[model samples]
Target: MKTRLFRMGLAVLSLAAGFTLAGVVGPAMAQQNVTLALPAQSLLFAPAYIAAERGYFREAGIEPKIVYVAGPGVLTAVLGKSADFAMISGGIQIAAAVRNQKLVAIANTQDRFTTDIVVRKPVADKLGAVPPGDALARIRALKGLTIGIDAVNGLPHSFLRYLARKAGMNPETDFTITALQPQAMVAAMKSGTIEAMAFSPPFSLTAVNDGGALWITGPDVDLPEMKTFPYNVVLVRPDYCQAEAAACRGFTTAIGKAVALMRSDPAASLAALGKTFDRMEPEALRQSFAIFAKYTRTDLGLTEDMYRNAVAFDRAGGVIPETAAVPPASELYAPSLGR
Candidate 1:
């Protein structure tokens, strides 16, 4: 018995040192099922889509099915168990908690705001915004002009509201706001009807290539409120996470690998993205990669500051009640089982 104990102890130590106490790669296990919802078809979820495209899901022994949901609906999908996981903004996660819905973010895909305010070239040139050289000045020039947004409660509109506040202008009082789809936004910009529009990738890229000026990029402009916000998160139910800890860990690990592939090999990453964004031109896809690469996260962790900001934004917008204003970020996260 003493010898058996000693051998067992040695085996554990060896296993910890990177030796799989192996039997061969045993017979394949049934593919674990996972359903993940994304907020949209944006390039922001590139890493995850890449994982699915590159067989990382297969390699991790998970069969992942991705669905596209818009806005807060992504969270609702996960909360109702219609999806096992979701990729959404941190704000929605915080807002749900205030309402007493128990969803948790297992991985954060971005720590900064990747969206920007893009203005039409003709509008910029007329306003002497030719390089949009000074953001504050150009912003001031937008007074009484028309601006477009994707939706009333979307990232574009939200950020635009924040920006107007910075210029000491009320979004409602200072200018006319119109909600238009990205395609329409582009058309409006070129047609000289809307002076500016704001949103995240794929669309942001389209805005620039179509003769709109990237007047201000969120983090790049050094906005303190925009930094460290965990704009994109990989979320799951706390109960679901606990029940399937191993699977959650494997899912995140596979995502980490996909993020790495995106950084280390642009060609391969672009190819992987092609499988999902097939409608985009090759140049357009490359343009999108250039715009969003900096925001992709290879490691996933939640942060308190991100939750604080998300909750504050939602509350200010009346999206969440004051009773749930302070959603605890720490309590809302259940890290994956140890690798």
Candidate 2:
């Protein structure tokens, strides 16, 4: 791991000194300015960063700007026309669709459900002998602990609830979930304010560096329900996608290219993203990218089965009410939006 991290770090440093890997690879077209809103700076959105850094967005004739906001604000950014696109959890989009909101998921970047349940090192030491592969056992051990999440109904919170329920515990009463930013969660864990946290890296990696241990890593846990689910997806207003078809398609294509890049060349992909995560430790960034690249979608298409699985996950987590009128995947997802 250390060797790979060092190699990737050097590769990225090379990019700083005029390493040209064809920033412009596609047809010449008019560049359109586009804004994208993201909920957090998790490695789950590595595709977006890589696309911008490696000039995939430029190749697709797009000048992209990424804006960070707290949970649910990403939805607001798209809805209010502040951003042309937003990368958000599939569960949030599904919940909005059930309410007849005008939203469409153009492409799924991170296709698998991912987050890490990290506990302080001391806490982990107490839960002895739990097999790393046994996701249920890992989750069962988290019962009655104060777990930190970034949002109230965001992916981390929903995922934690889902895991808790699957562990045969009452998600409502078995544990206390406190909402805090990723950085704050780390501080809380260090201060003993929270026992554990559930979030995506490099926050999880940061916690681990600060005397925390992984309880359940979403990518490593091979759960049937999480497979094929849309964890990080590019969302747009259907009307905007129709009116500005070129921009939408170009943006989607850029993301798809980034996804392909991540799979085809790890060092180059890491280099492309290194600029975005300059402050992160090289090792932690490499590990985080590894987790993200493992399950990023190659096709970028949003299938009916995928949306159905996401809906099921949200429903199980109580993010979507059982009585809500859920539309068919075809109504919510724009299969033609992506290249």
Candidate 3:
């Protein structure tokens, strides 16, 4: 009887040891830390803000730290590996790709263009009635006005150039395109320095609220050949996606969930996003969020169509030189990265 008991005890101890080893060798289920870079606080990233606020990133085993790097430095942040991902305009993303930057878009937040052009009410009054929805007439009216943009060669500047060309004016000679910070643009417009400004919300909306008139709005007026484009997207290094596949996949998944929530439950999502955009007026924030959600891609997938339109847009804006070789869209996005 003692020998039998000893044998049984040995078997039980051996089984317990095997289980412990398995636990040690198994895959981890803990949260992964990631850094995301942003240009500034704008409604263009509403989905990302929603994802973070609703614990969607946490649900995907990610702890995201948002780093604000102004200007075009968000690209540098990702390139230097200080950030795991960056939210930026597709035009800049494509421009980076043209210069041989190894960045691939894993998720797109907004599929339509988001730039807005607002003229000081006084300037609009001078233009007289151009009839709403007549984008060409509106563009023609700005021929002699000085327009302020956040950055030269950015979406706003390029868009103005494209519009100027379409309106039968030389982008270089017909009007002036000036670069200024958003606040500075506001002050300049108030002081009659800049006659007009082009930007994304709520700067555009704020200008409109403060006695400016909307000449073009992203969600309202449809421009030629800009039906489906990538306005805002999440970019990652191709190698990072390969090595840390889970992190990239998780980030995309979080964005997907956020987009779905924004579409399915607008009131709740807006209520949550309002907290993130606490500085903006509640109604203005709601309007911006609604416009964003309306244009957000449903699957959060980055398609080749989006890329092609972006290239065309960039070319139209003169951001992409005619002589430069454009890389294939396949090289710019990871289709498998999204949920």
User: Each model's C-alpha lDDT?
Assistant: 0.74, 0.84, 0.81
Best-to-worst ranking by lDDT: 2, 3, 1
Q: Estimate each model's TM-score.
A: 0.80, 0.87, 0.86
Encode model 1's per-residue lDDT on 202-294: one tens digit a residue: 777688888988887766755555667768788888777678876787688888888888778999989989978887777878977866777
Model 1 residue 224 lDDT score: 53
Clashing pairs in 3: none
Candidate 1 Cα lDDT to native = 0.74
Best by TM-score: 2
The segments of candidate 1 whose C-alpha lies over 4 angstroms from its true place after superposition are 1-27, 130-137, 173-175, 180-184, 187-194, 308-324, 337-339
Report the lDDT tens digits of candidate 2 across residue range 67-160. Answer: 9877777887898899989998888888877777658888888777668899998989998989999888889988889999998778888888
User: Cα miss at 74, model 2 (Å)?
Assistant: 0.9
TM-score result, candidate 1: 0.80
Kindly provide the TM-score of model 3 when superposed on the true structure, using C-alpha atoms. Answer: 0.86
